[model samples]
Target: MVPAERRTMSPALRRTLVIAILVELAVGGWLLASRVLRVPPALPADMVDDPLLAAEIRALASRADRGGTPEWRTLGEGLLGQGAYAHAESAFARAAALAPQDIDALFGQAFCIDRTGRMAASNPLYRRCLDLPDRTEDGVGRKPFALYAIGRNLLRLDDVQGAEAAFRENASFLPAQFQLAKLLVRDGRLGEAVRIVDDLLRQLPLALELHQLKARILEAAGAPAEAFLARAMEERSAHLVESNFSTDYVRPFTTRLGMPRVLQEVESRLPPVPGDPRRDPAVLEREIQPLEALVAEARVPQRATLAFLRGALAADVDDVAGITAALGIVDAAGDRSASRLELEALVRDRMGDAVTATALRERAAAMAPSPQLHRRLAEESERRGDHAAARHHRARADFHLGKAAYRRNRLEDALREFREAAVHDDRHVATWYRTGEMAYHLGRRTEAVEAFRRVVDLEPDHER
Candidate 1:
């Protein structure tokens, strides 16, 4: 019989094997129970007043009443309360699907999605709720919260113009005056923003946020003394918001002066040139006198900035001597590297010192090769017919400009710039090849072929 099989079937051995298997099975079952049977805690007693979400939750409750898992609702509410926004979103989505018309579930889903940083997804849902004909009259169409959400989202995306329009539309519906004040502050209407915040603080003296907003607005409006007082009040109110307040943890309010207004002021104070004859010399001197006086009285940073501005104005007027004088002032002030370099470049350029200008530009490039500066150098080199220098500068400029142009669908211009850039730097073989591909898309067959051939020569194995 094929080497008589050893009959090793002992009862004790079989019993031990069976017991081990049973223990494993018991452990696995416990693990499964732990994973699938654990229930989430209950929601807070006070329900959120968001009607759309509330209705959706009610529908989910109805589904639970119909013998669906009560665990689903519990999980969703628990996730929402604990700020587990993403988890809450999925749970609420399931709850909403199970009971579509449940306003609570829908609102919960939207709220969770919004809080989870899914503005693109949440916006449409919020809009859909607002568009519904059967929406409740509890200010559904005119709800400040919904409007604020949309506005805040737009602001976060840097869609300032859109945010301004939305905020204006919903200004009347906002529950707190502070919200409107903050929006105004964001819009650069510091005076109005401050007025609104002041009104709110009169009613709610404990509103530290309102006080801080007022302080920021006042500072932006140039009322430094009043701003400091308001900041003091804000610190006092901080203790009420939370005990054991620490200054290090507190967010200091910021003041942002409007760029356009600052530019306008700088422009207005610029000294007039003699050759322009556009305005009276006396009038120009009078206009600039106040600026000079202000410069003397200003803080170090502001004085340095003003000195740079004056240098720029002098260069604009072809006043080489004046430019040099202003640059000296800036240098004496110190701690204005950017302004110093900028003024130096301007003066050098104005004085027809191309070599000096190039040196300064190279230094600036090494420091910070901003696209504007690169383009300036490129254009200047091109004007002087220095093709090699132009090519180098253009390559630098194109590195930045190409992406911006591509984003704006100016493919032809981008292709041209990339091609020119490739000609400037043979080491950028990949960029050269990409230029050919872009040229092909732009229908420049001859240019594309030349670019491709160049790439092929650079790298024999390069695939077209």
Candidate 2:
């Protein structure tokens, strides 16, 4: 065997070995070259940090710094600041992509999108920034700012529950002192929001924004006297701000800071009504016309507020027609105003238009998808003697209400609640046909017959 193995290699075999070795070396060389020469994949085109994009971003930033001609960032900021949402949105979108993680750019983009009536678009950006890992010494994450942005966006989208959830989530992140207490109050979580502001006020006593926020919150929570006092303090701060600045500067500053005063004046001007006769028709009608006029000229938030005020005035005067009219105005004023829709349902109920009211309530229920709205609609259906419709609405209401009650350990209450619900809506077809079912339930044979007769008429094969 050694003798055979040791024989000299053949020319063809030697050539093959050499060829294989050369191929391997060639492949290895190619791989090594690829590794050394290849560039890393570029960051997203919009991300301003990209080396390739840095020059363009720097150019834009320089232009913004110049501040005379409208540069991308400055134009966006100015439009956003001035509440020209649609224009701001276009500008900020460009800026955000150019500087992806630029906090001001992100905030401006999100705010402008939201202002331009695009809550769905704004929410994701707010969430992304809010979810960013915290590097601050406090380690408190961006939760507060994120929560506030989300809540504001939800409010604009007419998602009250979603807004509440977001506000509650970041309520703790609010700088132990900030000036948005009023927003929290309007959110119906006033107590918690107020506590945060109170702590902040202790630290930054001279902060005009805090005082204004506190006043607005107090006013929203129905603490008029405290709000008035807070307003006075804020006014003093406004004067202080003006006195500290040049005349030209003061005028612009006051114009920007005058929201609190305008709000206070509006609240103060609302006429008081007597408790026993809250709905003084004349006063209600008188108050509504001006509010309607305001609705026509106001922006989204202001218009929504005015519409709500008009609705309240109409309710005070027991003017169903006025209330209905105000609701229509509110509905037309903005896509984000659902509170007005809710008020409209109430007005319809008060007007004794149960059938139409039920439909309106159902529409609201569909939009907000709330248990309360469903319950109201179910009750209205029961009142109208539409057992089938009543059953459907009641089942939906009971399903949600039961979950709510069960979470609170009210099992018996939930069961009784459903049982009571069943009395109003006999779901089974047999309930309609049983001889005494309708009579006993309705308390009148003729009424039962009429109801059953209608059911039978609709369902030709049904028997009584």
Candidate 3:
């Protein structure tokens, strides 16, 4: 008590004085920074003005996981993954400023900026990662990631050899090796591409990407039979994933494993561009063996399904007998099945029976809201000059396409498709809901909230 008796100032006054001194010091530091540094901090100019963006920035900044440079870098990487480009750039820039010697921060900053499509601006930042003395003495750090990204941008800039050199620097990185194989293929180095794909396939036999790349490499190498077979294997894997998860309805994780985009990509990668006769009849016939082999290996119930695919392909190749036999496998007398109707439409379309094809597509559209059936209906309506009907059908097609992308957890693609659907017809509650969901996943808070509000307005009691 005696020791504490002689305070020169009141505790409250002392506390207030201390706070005032801190405020003056902070203001002086700000002024000094403005005068001496002569450069504003690397931050988004509209961050404070954009309420939704500010909320996101604040949420990230206040996260308990945030404590220092490493955590900031990690948070930045996560934001980049979630498509929050501006916020990620800010976080990375701050981390790099705090610890100028941090390779991870430097790389992250470049990578985040690169993701925003500013390839030119990111180049120097990426170079800094490689040139820095902060590079670890032994372990693989962000070097491989940086190199792979550089290779991608270099290719975009038409520097193929430079891209190859960058990719080659990280031989063990799978994406780098994968891209290197593609570059080798583009340059007619088929043998090298084949070896790379073979090694990758050995390591990841079930990877849809590797299988698709292998198919192209084999096709490039004049191994059409091998290409056809590899493509079949990829389809088989895809179907297995679809079969397991299509009924889940909510959990998209397993659906993502199915790789729906792979099938779409296959349409482009495969021989025929639709409405173009680039696919040789002989080549198409050669493809029949792989289809037949898959059918032979499949369960009894799957044979008829494979036969449906066989018929559709046969129609494309002008194989009348093959189409007839495959149809016989279906044996659906007076059938109303959507798959059979769709196959019939393809057959009729190939036979130049436009009237019959349109009729069949309309019938299929009634039973199932598939994009194919709806798109055909849209085309038919447009041809008839029924603009409203055409728009309605087109919206349905986009909605269906969006649903497929959504179920596969391709949020960005799903959001795009849903937005397109809305452009055609914005009345559907489900479309709004899905649009909101995708926006939410991509960290598009404003769009998500707006879409959700639209949903509530469209259907008051719609299940969340």
Candidate 4:
């Protein structure tokens, strides 16, 4: 009896041992795969000296031929970091086609779109990826990046509250945090913006961008001394002072390819004021000397963009000859024709050459139609008491803006846009229809009925 019991117990113990071993092996395999999948390849020192290394790396990736694999996704990330956005987009698209469930591919595609200035078009893709199961290896999941992207696009669409909510969902996202601080400053909530900047500085003491941002906030808050000190700190930051390249360019992996151009564009659009510290003449002169040298030395499109920026600075000071000289350089480049034309129109309009300005405007309108430009034209026409033209342009601007908002599913924003269109031109039947539809969905029955009545008044045979 004892021998029989021992035989049965030995079989049972062996089975239990086998099960435990299998479980351990499974866990170990998962851990190894996770680590291997998450680690990015290190960049070689030669990559710094040889800018073409990115192309070589991409060539190697093309030979991998392992669709849906981690290798393709990694290569996509590397290409994106190197600013080959079109190539990176292709790689990500291939990966996504191979593995429809892969969030990384989807995110990469959306990121590339944003880099290419298609932020609004990337929104639906972001929403789809974020709705997937949480496969993000990072502890924050996809919320930080997705919310940041959504918030940025929403801000562009004029959905302020929606943008604020999206940004507030992920404070760890530095871009969104920076935007939030800017919004706070814009809304006169200086204390809140300052607190946010302080918190960010505590986490990233070496962040020169944050320092620059803080400088802007302080200047807005009437602290010129503090603002200047912040700028000094930004300039002295090791990340900037240690670099021969532009601080933004040196941190290529942390910034988008067109960041410098975007920053320059923003600066160019600032209201021309002689002594505005934000556009200080002394600082502009200091900054442009290096940029001018770089433009002469560099052979990239950045040179043309920089030349345009210099022209913009000259325009700020009403230096017509300086502006003409700078613009001539940009015109010679042949890449900024549209932008050059727009700038010429602006200068002519500001200098009170209405005939030339009108001709430029007609040319510009033929090239591109922007809601912002139309709205500006409307405002200018209103100022000149050209009510008919103002009404026409206002109707065009609001109609376009409303349709854009509607496409983004910003119903309330669309409603407001449509209402503005109606205010500008009550006979705009499409605007009245959209207003009624949006109001109905929002459960404002009375407003919906009123809007529908207007639509019927405009077009009696209009179908819902």
Q: Scored by CA lDDT, what does every candidate get?
A: 0.62, 0.57, 0.69, 0.70
Q: Highest TM-score among the candidates is held by which one?
A: 4
Comparing candidate 2 with candidate 4, which one achieves the higher lDDT? 4
lDDT tens readout by residue for model 2, 283-332 = 54565565445335434345555667777876766778877776776777
How close to the true structure is residue 97 of candidate 4, measured as C-alpha lDDT?
A: 71
Model 3 is weakest, by summed lDDT over 10 consecutive residues, at: 240-249
Worst 10 residues of 1 by lDDT: 247-256
Q: Per-residue CA lDDT of candidate 3, range 18-106, in tens?
A: 99999999999998885686432233444333233345544555651336677676557545544557776877887898798898778
1 or 3, greater by TM-score: 3
Query: How many clashes in each structure?
Result: 18, 4, 0, 0
Best first by lDDT, ranked: 4, 3, 1, 2
List residue ranges in candidate 1 displaced over 4 A: 1-287, 329-339, 349-354, 366-387, 394-401, 423-464
Q: Identify the superior model by lDDT, candidate 1 or candidate 3.
A: 3
Clashes of 4: 0
TM-score of 3: 0.40
